[model samples]
Target: METKNINIPAHGSNVLRADIPAEYKWHVQDIYADEAAWQAACAEFKALLPQLEALKGSITSAQGLYNALHLQDKMSQMLDKLYAYPRLQQDADNTDQHLQAIAGEAEALAAAFSSANSFIEPEMLGLGKEKVAAMLAELPELAEYKFYVENLLRITDHILSADKEAIFAQSRLATGTAASAFRSLVSADMEFPPITDGEGKPAIVSEGNYMLNMTSPDRELRKNSFRGLMGTYHKYRNTLATTLTGSARTAYFYASVHNYKDTLESCLAEDNIPTSLYDGLIQTVHDNFAPLHEYIQLKKDVLGYDEFHPYDLYMPLSKAADSFACTFPEACAKVEEALAPLGEDYIATLHKGLTEGWIDIYENKGKRSGAYSWGVYGVHPFVLLNYQQRYSSISTLAHEMGHALHSYYSSMNQTYVNSEYTIFCAEVASTTNENLLLEYTLQRANDEQKIYLLNQFLEAVRTTVYRQVQFAEFEKFIHGEITAGRSLQAEKLENYWLESNRQYYGPALTVDQELASEWSRIPHFYTPFYVYKYATGYSAATAFSSAILSGAPDAVEKYLGFLKAGGSDYSLNILKNAGVDLNTPQPVTVTLQKFA
Candidate 1:
């Protein structure tokens, strides 16, 4: 595949999927060839569920265990491919009813697969560790699953009875109701009134364009966009509150049933992360507030605002880099040049992904708003990007490709069972790329551009580290409230969010009332305790990128090893061996000091 010359459509064009060239769109066919093939695979997968059920109670023997495990891997790989096709299509253009129906069907199939396969773990746990170890030793081929078995046995205390496990697995179908409702409400139901654009024309306020509006130089537009966005959520406050409360309660229910102390423990336990690390992240950020405050104060000074408001936060301080923009091809070239420090092989693979139909490179009518990188186990990774002709879009390209390359390396090296990495380490690869891109751009910048790029780096750390930790702190509070038998009422949640913002941003900034409703709009809150990883990942990336750029011995080699390790080992241990340790506060503190 060769790189194609494609330009992003002008803003507000309402470009259709057919308007974009084929190369600019990802090849979902690469997963299944067509919908007919996907349907056939789904049927084949359904037929194999009974076969998996047949091995449920037969894992006592070495051969029985191997057969069950191997079959499970095979089925899982099939399901991954099966699910990826429709989800990718739906994300590309969600307006199509057929795509929506298939996506829903794929989700249902996944839930069914989960319920059917729930018995494997409990049954394996029933055999006892020593017996399972004996079976593993008896079968040389089982060596591949030794780590998995050991990890399972390590959490044996949490594994419930077979019946209870089945109930829990079936609960998967209902567990996502809160999150699903939240997505529907925000994406489809909620409507923000149009705000004036920087040019004094009416611009629609959407989740996609909200950030773009925030970055606009027009002060009224920024304030109105902020007000319009958050005020709409405020109008639906009660409904949004109920949805979030349901999500929290759901998490608490699972935590309590699993014998964990709290939702935080239950969430971190999967990756073997300690609750102390999560707590320490908040405390460490609290301890190091001067740099953040100083930055905020500088922003206020630069913007010449008597009262600094939430809407003013994203405004570019440097006029020079504020107008920076790049087309999709230019963004790709910039990212490739920025990532060249990872060596020729890494860049070559990245170029292949950029050129080949591995990316849906531009936003279209009804496409997903944000960006992500996801892939089937055996096939190459795919990236969904709403590419704009701006520096932020370039950085986003680098960030997501970092995820893509991480997935690519892991899938190439690990089995399907371990190809998926934990959320704890997911941000490391992506942020490292962002950090490298910033560094590359800064190095090549003139004096005026340097000021802008430096501010960009500062804002990245502030957002990725400080802002995320603030969100983490809020998560801990809300979950603790639920754990303590309290409710997450709308007003109560809003009040807490206000106070938290004040404490984090300090007196340098005025806490707007609209900002209090900000918590209601964050979709990540549906996934309890997940946001802190962005902060931790940024810290770890800072460490890795510093070392790699400073010519540390084998730094690139070590970082690549971390990517390839995937979920094959514990997340913390993987990072430890790769040189950053989240077990201590050094990484966070060191990252903050750089900001200072």
Candidate 2:
């Protein structure tokens, strides 16, 4: 039977941004009172640029170094406000050319600020280790920046000469074009063929609804959407191949230039992650493939499908069961209930933020898809959502709130330099919220809801854990191939992706030729070695959340400490303090046991 196409029009497709209710929108005005105020602030920030620039070549004394560091921090704080305001405005309605222009100007201003300050690092390194240490001793204020000082001295070899660093700073845009080009292709240029729904209605295939289509109970429609989407990617294989290959090479380029052994090392070094941690994640997933394969087979049995295809992966076994939908207020209330273990203060803060304009809750025309918790140092965290009243949406709400609260706590507790969390730890908080919501719901659910919850958990593990590991492995493979002087041709990438899928999905699923083009669609590939963190973070979160739900003493406290710690410590160290070690496979093993 043909599957009925679900028509959940992406929120931003038809409505005016202004028409969205004020209660449902984010109040960015708190960041800057108005455009005039933002403009005035921008002027002041521009005036301070030369002041920061003047400190270059004069770091011989402690006071001079202290002044430069403080001025730089102040400028950065102002620039965050300047950059975030328009950027959020543009994201609210990307079709607005005025807002887009403003966003562009903000970006350019940031780039210019970065370029102007590029001399600081190189010149500081040039001052020689003895001089820098002596200055630190001479100026006791520098003691607060002890971590910053040691980190700089540690990477002295990677710090380029002033001219080289300046020239390299100017090349950021050109180097980033591959990813930008891929985004434009998929989001703006590529189009999928319309597929008829099971209701005998025509449904447009879009990035927004393609996954929703995949979850259709009707087999034919799922096949159609799958084919339609992947087929489009197949058509643009060459262009995408060039983009992917270029991006992979770009990662290698940056790593080689900086004297790292490979791109993974280069990327992970920012958070002090060792290459063994990355490798251990992949190895652990391989060891735990039994649970994943067993789950896939269970899916086939539950759905009564004699043959399972890649297209059949998303739908639950019982299609006719009652599905979940909640209003925005309902979802918020549920979130508050699910996170009750975290104490009243945490929930109250989240509630205040939600009601007091910290969330942009609905979709409007030209609004960005997906959700995120975004904020600057001096402001409260803001969440962006294209919230549809589905169960996943509730989980998304929880997830983003997880991020928002993490930012809130970190900002309240840490210095500006340390307030921002690394991406490695960032996903942990979000996924932990998801685990809590799942567990809380399961606790009160009937048999039907229990089944649905289990299915949802499995699907989450599959996508975030298995699928992400596949991507990560694919990244490692391509990077290895590229670094070894193998050309990243389209066919080569497709084969690598195909093998990764087969390994991850196992013998129960059919691996088709069209699936080969899947690599072209992942935006993360452009970022290089980033997808692995999703798997690692999700695994770590599952462990942390389970501990908290078990009511272990200090579990919630340790998790909260993890959030507040932010970049104050390296990511693994933060996780270690919170009670999971990614360097070992225990978290991965414990996470998989949940599936078994």
Candidate 3:
């Protein structure tokens, strides 16, 4: 996707100046040229049922099974287009009726495909992986799909009863609806308190306005907004809890019905991510508590606060009056130039992304808040950012673009069946780009940019590594308690959160009384222990970034290979493919040493 020809105007101080750039409006035509064509494809997918059924019995032998799997891969790959069109379309201008309908059509298509998929897993398990692999080895078509087949086979031990699995699959209408509704609620309905300026003057606050306020150079106003927003959100904690609990219950229910021991086991079982990776993050954080505490001390000292509080964390430690503020186009150029070490091919894709219409790069009316990179498979990634004119906001451009470029490269290279990389490897790509951008900017810096880049790196280390590890540890504890059949009461959750704050911060900083409610606000806890990678990814990315910058022999080649790998390898193997060993303690220790 490219935004080259789109007419987007960056107008106003706090308002969206540009309409949705044309090319940035995903190439839905890549899936089907028009609504009528989408309907035609829908009919085609449904018409294949007789064929999908015929392959069921025929897949009993190796050749028959290999042929069937190849065909199934085609059907599934095409269905992605049929499903992805709506979600991406709706996400662009979430309120558009046509886009919403498009999303609905895609989801309905997915449901139909799931009905077909409900049989594939069980039938494959029924055939037994060993027999299927032996037969697949002899067939050329199936050989390329071994990783996918092996991925499926590895989870056969946890396969639910065929009847139970089918019921769960069909129940997507109700079960998925619950989560979807809450997502809409949070995205489209939730509101916050009015923001105040540095002198405690009142200002209007809305979903899209809070980001500009949070990055305000006025420490006091940022604090006021942070406190006020947290206070307002705390009021809806119970409601948000319902949203999260409903999602968790669905996870728990499926895990239980699917014959898995618990939610964590079931989640990691399919993804092939080990529970130890999660545990490794927590243990590493616990062992390195002192650096985090020292980093907190560094903030308190630099900010000249009598005692540091959590609200003070996001504020910058140093700022210069004569700073260069980047407009959207300039930021894009900086990012593209900074990441040039990734090779010409990578830079060219980013160039197309900027020029062609892959980015919706401004704040606008009724736009969904926050930044993200998303699109259906086969199309280039689109980025949504409310690009305010601030230095840190420029880093955000680099960050979201990292995700977009990662998606772009992976989709271009891999088939839809295996194109999308897991969240486990996701943060590294984005964070690695941030690292590169910082290195390049800092290397070319005057005193001000150097200070800004150093402080930015500090913030990155603190937020991604320390803060997320803290969340990861908290999530693990919460899940362990829940899995052990204990209730996750709000009071218990707060106490553990505050106690955690004490341990991680040491005896230095005073914990805010109200901030004890932080646990109630973190939605990651509800995702069943998912935030650890934010820390581990940063640590790993730091090592990788250092290598590429150090100009070590073959360093750039290895790092680029990692980026191009897509979902061709598992998370650990992907890192090893790029030349880092997660199993050894090296990456963790290296990150800690950098902090020291």
Residue-pair clashes per candidate, as listed? 0, 5, 11
- Which has the higher lDDT value, candidate number 1 or candidate number 3? 1
lDDT against the true structure, each candidate: 0.87, 0.82, 0.71
The TM-scores of all predictions, comma-separated, are 0.97, 0.93, 0.90
Query: For model 1, what is the C-alpha lDDT against the true structure?
Result: 0.87
| Most TM-score-accurate candidate | 1
Cα deviation at 227, candidate 2, in Å, is: 2.2
Error of 3 at 265 (Å): 2.4
Tens-place lDDT digits, model 2, residues 1-596: 11145333435445788777676788989899999998899889889888877887877688888887778878888899898999888778766778867876777778777777888888888889999988898888887666677677877887788777777776775687787677657654576787886776877666666666677787788888888889999999999988888888888887888889888889888777888888888888898898888888888888888898898898886542336675677788888899999888899988887678889887776676678889678889889988876788889999999999999999999888777898888889899999999999999887888888888998998899888888888888888988997768888888888888888888898888889998888877887778888888899998888799889989989988998897887788888988888778787777777777
As a TM-score, model 3 comes out at 0.90
Q: In model 3, which regions exceed 4 Å deviation? A: 1-37, 96-98, 206-211, 321-324, 517-526
Instruction: Estimate, for each residue in 298-321, the C-alpha lDDT of model 1 and write its tens digit.
Output: 999988899999999988787665
Pairing residues by index, what is the TM-score of model 1?
A: 0.97
In model 1, the worst 10-residue window by lDDT is 5-14
Error in Å for residue 287 of model 2: 1.8
> Looking at candidate 2, what is the lDDT of residue 493?
81
Q: With candidate 2 superimposed using the best TM-score fit, by how many Å does residue 277's alpha carbon deviate from the native?
A: 1.1
